[model samples]
Target: MIHTNTAMKTQYHPISILFHWLVVVLLIAAFVVIELKGQFPKGSEARELTKTIHGFIGQIIFVIMVLRLFARILFGAPEPKNPSQALAMLSKVMHWLLYAILLIAPIFGILYFQYAGKEIHFFGFTWPQLVTPDPVMKKSVENIHELLGNSLYFLIGIHALAALWHHYFLKDDVLTRILPKMKGVRN
Candidate 1:
């Protein structure tokens, strides 16, 4: 059984909201840079530069995800405004899946670079090539990274749609929970 309560209004911590939107922006940048890289011919400097920028963005995302996880633990989220048991369960599963992908995808990207025996240059520093060059392993890890990267599109779309569904169809505060509060605006 479930009941909708319009009076219940709780929002996420301000810091949590910042981190959430920051990650979203970073993810968009990452995708854009990688896609833009394809416009440049292979082996061109512009292509490599975009790839490096994408890597830097990925690294930043990984660090923020770690912080976000800690913030989530320390400052737990508000309960959904009157969700059914099934909706609550589904929300939890979706969130955990998103967290797993955000955390693990970067590691796989790093491993791909390592397996390819390439140094990751970030802001004048270089990451050591931790793994010996193995063409076979490099290709395998690249495939995995690509698969995870592609899955993000589907997962993010569903997440966004679910939030919209809650906001418009269910008339719930689910979307506004993570949105920043504005003056003279009611969430």
Candidate 2:
């Protein structure tokens, strides 16, 4: 078994906490921009601009995820305090699912753009097209990307609810483990 100093550590590393919340904010911005795009007419500049903004946010999220993964490996997470084996297993699976979605969704988004014969202009840089333009492939990839994007809503909802449940009902540090520690205040 992998051993950890669970009693000594009450929270995740500060960097991990930052990365977790940063990704949450970025995801929210990405979803908002895409939805906001609908307010503009199709093919209009405002719509296209919102799409570009969404793409940028996705790219940023992908980069942060890579860094976050490294940070997770370098500074391991604190173990849950006195969790049931089943609950611990469920938490592990949920976390893996969340990580998979965050990483894969962005890749499919990039492929969707490439298959549609469009380059992703992320901030001031352009991402080269990885695949030759193909209308059929574009449609297929777009569907997969959208499906994964939609899945985020359900996964994130369950995650948030689980955290709240642990905090309020179960009265555990499961939620505070990933929350930022305030100065002059205890978690």
Q: Superposing all C-alpha atoms, what RMSD in Å does each candidate have to the true structure? A: 4.8, 2.5
| Residue-pair clashes, model 1 | 0
Instruction: Write the residue-wise lDDT of candidate 2 on 37-152 in tens digits.
Output: 88999999999899778878898999998888777777777765436888777877888799988999999989988998887887668887778999999999989989999999
Per TM-score, the best of the predicted structures is: 2
Positional deviation of residue 145's Cα in model 1 after best superposition, in angstroms: 0.8
- Candidate 2 lowest-lDDT run of ten: 1-10
Pairs that collide in candidate 1 are none
Estimate, for each residue in 113-187, the C-alpha lDDT of model 1 and write its tens digit. Answer: 888777887678888777898889989998998898899999999999999999999987889889999999987
**lDDT for residue 134 in candidate 2, whole number 0-100:** 99
How accurate locally, in lDDT, is each candidate? 0.85, 0.86
Each candidate's TM vs. the true structure?
Answer: 0.90, 0.91
Candidate No. with top lDDT: 2
